[model samples]
Target chain A: EAAVTQSPRNKVAVTGGKVTLSCNQTNNHNNMYWYRQDTGHGLRLIHYSYGAGSTEKGDIPDGYKASRPSQENFSLILELATPSQTSVYFCASGDAGRSSYEQYFGPGTRLTVL
Target chain B: AQSVTQPDARVTVSEGASLQLRCKYSYSGTPYLFWYVQYPRQGLQLLLKYYSGDPVVQGVNGFEAEFIKSNSSFHLRKASVHWSDSAVYFCAVSVGSTGNYKYVFGAGTRLKVIA
Candidate 1:
């Protein structure tokens, strides 16, 4: 089974604080993504990376930035966190191997910004 | 722009009962459809997907879905649901080629299974 692991499963931050969430995948997938989940709002993509040193903005990328330092690691950064940024964040990895359609997600990080 | 609509916000069913979660998509060309389940405090897991050929596809945990191109719908169904099946279900669609990996998700449907 493909394994995607995320760090700091639960987080609490004050407004204007800098917060970072990390993810690692052993599946050797070429694509990684960040998303936030909210009640009644569903999951919305924030950022995605094609590979190392490549990051692309998603539908809801305004207050978030993503980094892929290596093929196995991806990080979501909140430079200046705010109350609105409080939500459950998920990291996912997908391999375009004949099919870019399916994405495997890691356990989410619940962020609370006061 | 591509979009998905999961009209039901919540669904309640007794254990061992049949299940159906509605999902509709709006996109030009052949669409790539998917269903994912998110358990409490867990990540979303792919339940099933439909690309072409088969109108009905089976997934894990006795779950399945049927694609009706005429109505632009891909509804998820389960013959006998278990209590562990309670979770939030998301319907998603990717426009154009799947290689592009662009996806649009619905608001989600929360399922509550009564034992």
Candidate 2:
């Protein structure tokens, strides 16, 4: 029951528009993440991947940019969007050989930069 | 420099009542705790996790959590609560290792279940 799927969901850019947020995982889990849930700053890791092409840089990675061309897909790039990059954006999938690494989420994308 | 503290941002129980949501962590070693549950737009799930011997772990629905390494704390429990259990409650901490782990979240705890 670990299926992470996200795309579009809700968006409305305009600052410099180039937004793109999409993630897909069918349990193949090899680690993949990109978070951004403000409101007191709860979730913040901005990019992560450890399979297919690799890409890592968490702890609020600047304006954001990431892509893992394989291993079930993972992408989060906002080339030039602004308005503080809006908010709510999450996509996770984990399987560090499992020992309770626990992670498998995707049901968010609500961005809104204007 | 790992951190996670959920010093009660908001909590209000009622229906059947009985719940505790609080977490703290500074990380020095032996840490890998988690307890998530976000249900508004949805995105976080997994209501229990603690690496190492049992310190009282049990999750999903009934929920439960307790791992106090000399009070670094990892609180989250429930005895009855219902209102769909309200929402928002996160507390995570997973320092680096094996595939480069690093998850430190905590600024959540917004449950409101009244009758």
Candidate 3:
């Protein structure tokens, strides 16, 4: 079955520390996205990739950076983590065309920055 | 700019009762609409989506949504609710024919089913 997975389901980091979150997708989709879910605010996109070596800033990309080293792997990096950045992160994968825009999501990663 | 709105912040219903979650979108042009459910400590899963064709679309777990273009609303409903149905429901929107449109999601409505 097509699936998306994220590692380090729970993490606690100090402010100004470097944090990396990883995701893998077996869906073989061309598009991948990283979103943060917060209370009273819905899922907001941080960054996305069209494919390998392609990363694009999303709605809220100020404090985050993303890397797509390969077709199946995408990583979100926080160079200087902050308490405000603590939230549940979700990674998703979708197909290329408009007809296949529906995305599949990972289990989600809980990050807490002290 | 495109946006999605889920008016109710929370809803509580008794088990075996009916359920309806309201969702509205603000997009002048035709758009894709979807309903996603998130269980406690879990990620979101698609419940149903409406692009074209029938105003109503059926999804997993006996869920369904009706797209009313005139009102710009896509409301999800279920005839009978179970305790397991308690979760957060989010409504999202995007351009249907565009390949790069990022989905805009609503704040989400937390549904509580009391036994």
Candidate 4:
């Protein structure tokens, strides 16, 4: 089955520390996305990539950076972790050319910045 | 700008009862609407989507959604909901001429199914 897996299913980081959340997709899809879920906001897009070496900012990209080094891998980087950045992060893969279709999601990584 | 709205923050229904979750969208051109469900502590999963063609689209778990172009609404409905059907539902809209587009999601509606 098509799958998107994220590393560190749960993580707790100290404030001001650096954190990296990794994601890998076995479907080899061209589109990869990073989203953060929180109460009352649902899932908010943080960053997305059309393909390898192409990362784009989404609606909320203030404190996050994304990297898509290859078609099957995408990573979300937090240069400096903050309490506000703590949330459940999800990685998804899909076809960018067909945006009207569904995007498969990973289990999600729950991060808590103290 | 494209936006989605799910007015109710929460809804409670008894098992085996009919269910409906409201969703509305705002877009200039023809919009691509979708409904996704996320169970507790799980990732979001696609329930149904509306692009064109038939207004009513059937999805998994006996869930279906109808696209009302006039009202810019794509409401999800189920004939009978089970206990496992309880989840948070999200409505999203994609705006753009081509199929490749970014989706804007609503705050979401949490549904509770009673036994």
lDDT of 1 by residue, A1-114 (tens): 789999999999999999999999998888888989998889899999888999999998998888999999999999999999989999988865724578889998999999
| Per-residue lDDT of model 2, residues A1-114, tens digit only | 779999989999999889989999988878888999999878989999978799999988998889999988999998999999899999998976853688888998999999
Candidate 1 off by > 4 Å: A98-100, B96-98
Every model's Cα RMSD, please? 1.4, 13.8, 1.4, 1.5
TM-score of the second chain of model 4 compared to its true counterpart: 0.95
Candidate number with greatest lDDT:
3
Q: What's the TM-score of each model vs. the native?
A: 0.95, 0.34, 0.96, 0.96
Off by over 4 Å in 3: A96-99
What are the interface RMSDs of all the models? 1.4, 8.1, 1.3, 1.9
Of candidates 2 and 1, the better by DockQ: 1
lDDT of 1 by residue, B2-111 (tens): 88999999999999999999999999877889999998888999999998897999999999999999999999999999999999999998754444576789999999
lDDT of each: 0.90, 0.89, 0.91, 0.89
lDDT of 3 by residue, A10-91 (tens): 9999999999999999888888899999999989999988889999999899999999999999999999999999999999
Query: Lowest-lDDT window of 10 residues in candidate 4 chain A?
Result: A94-103
Tell me what TM-score chain B of candidate 3 gets against the true chain B.
0.95
Across B20-80, the per-residue lDDT of candidate 2 in tens digits comes to 9989999887798999899999899888898889898998889889898998999999999
lDDT, residue A52, model 2: 79
Candidate with better TM-score, 2 vs 4: 4
In terms of lDDT, model 3 sits at 0.91
Give the range of the ten consecutive residues with the poorest summed lDDT in model 2 chain B: B93-102
TM-score (chain A only) for the predictions, listed in order? 0.96, 0.33, 0.97, 0.95
| Candidate 4 residue lDDT tens string, A5-74 | 9999999999999999999999877788899999999889999887899998999999899999999999
Q: Per-candidate DockQ versus the true complex?
A: 0.75, 0.29, 0.70, 0.64
